[model samples]
Target chain A: MDRQAWTTLFHRLLFTSAVWIVLSGTDAKALAVGAFAVPAATWLSLRLLPGRDRLVLWRFLRHFPSFVGGSLQGGVDVARRAISPGMPLLPGWVEVPVRLPDGGRVALGAELSLMPGTLAAGVRGDRLLVHLLDTDAGFENAIPREEAAIAAMILGTGKEVGP
Target chain B: MNDLATYAFTSIGLFFFVAGSVGFLRFPDVFSRLHALTKADNLGLGFIALGIAFQAESWRLVALLFLIWGLMLLAAGTMSQLIARDALRERDGR
Candidate 1:
């Protein structure tokens, strides 16, 4: 394996080990089992989905707070709209032009789905089809903002990559 | 103080869960129901995990709770996409 591949393997090992410790705790017997299990799982993971782009941790950390807050707000918004007697909803679909690569696009879709009133339904051509609970809920601004954040985290560059 | 936080968080979490269920029953279509179930239930689980974390005896258990919540968020996000895609396809008669 090349240096990049090795680095990816090492990171995967570290992550799988952390998951193992979380799952089985730090007991000696559990560690003994994990000794066999962790590496096997990491190897299987690499085989199934080899690392291509590394997520920039600091970038992700910087954006994490806002992402959490947005999703929380999303939950509250949906709950409020759902329980209201009027049941105010203006549900519809909107297409946002996709600018990032596949990995960044998937991350963007997932993050947008967790944000207020937006669920990414599918991709068409170079645009993402997002379902909105309310067309006028200001998703116009939110979607682009989230796309930039995911692009920064995955690609390490905030610049728009495509026209 | 800890008990107070636990109770408060748990109550808020349960409230969200109930709201999600209500939304599921009230929402008119599959897409709307998906919104309620995925978003509200995830936040509900997050708060409930936070509440449990407050009462956890060790940091390890707290970490475990957080990991579980994070995993759930990822799963819910991905599943919502798959479901929404299928629903759209079905509606289009594809």
Candidate 2:
């Protein structure tokens, strides 16, 4: 395996082991089995999904907290909207032009959809169709900032190969 | 104290679930309904997991709760995207 491949494999092994630890409740006997099982699973996974994106750990670490915060805030915002006696909803679709490549764009779309007020509708060329629960929710600026964060974390080296 | 915290978290979680249901029923269109369900459920489940975690005996259970919530979030996001895309396509076709 090449350097990149090895790196991916190692990361996958670490992740699978952690999963096993969590799932087995850190039981010593369970971990004994997991020591072997996790590596085998990682190997199988690598074979099934080869040549995937190289995950930059530092970038992921940096933005992960913000992502969690955003998601929590998203939940609160939507909960408040849902419970309001006077439902204040101004539903509209907005097309935002994004510079991120195809993969990054998809990631951004998925991320945006998970948020409280925004749902990504479709991708047409360089623009993404986004549905807003309320246009007044200030997504115009918010989306771009998220786009930048996603690009930095997942895009790796600021290079776009396609789309 | 532990019981109080657990009750508080669980109530909040149930409250969000109720709110989401109301939004789902009252919202006019598919897109809006999707918004309500996805957002409220994400938080609802999170709070519920947190409540359960507080009462859990081991750290592993807490980790498992978080893992479940993370997986739910991913599923919600993917499912919403698929539904929204289909709805948009149908609208365009009309």
Best by TM-score: 1
Output the TM-score of candidate 2: 0.88
True contacts kept of each: 0.66, 0.67
lDDT of each: 0.88, 0.82
Q: Summarize candidate 2's per-residue lDDT along B2-90 as a digit string, tens digits.
A: 88889999999998888889889988799999988888888789899988888998888899999999899888888888899999999
Model 1, position A9, has a per-residue lDDT of 89
TM-scores of all candidate predictions against the true structure: 0.96, 0.88
Q: After superposition, how far is residue A131 of candidate 2 from its true place, in Å?
A: 0.2
Minimal lDDT window, size 10, model 1 chain A? A154-163
Tens-digit per-residue lDDT, A1-163, candidate 2: 7898787877888888888888885678997898789989898888875646555679878888888787777777776777788888899988988887666777788788766589887788778999998998785557877887777766565444322
Q: Which candidate tops DockQ? A: 1
In candidate 2, which residue pairs clash? Answer: none
- DockQ score of each predicted structure, in the order shown: 0.81, 0.66
**Cand. 1 Cα-lDDT:** 0.88
Best by lDDT: 1
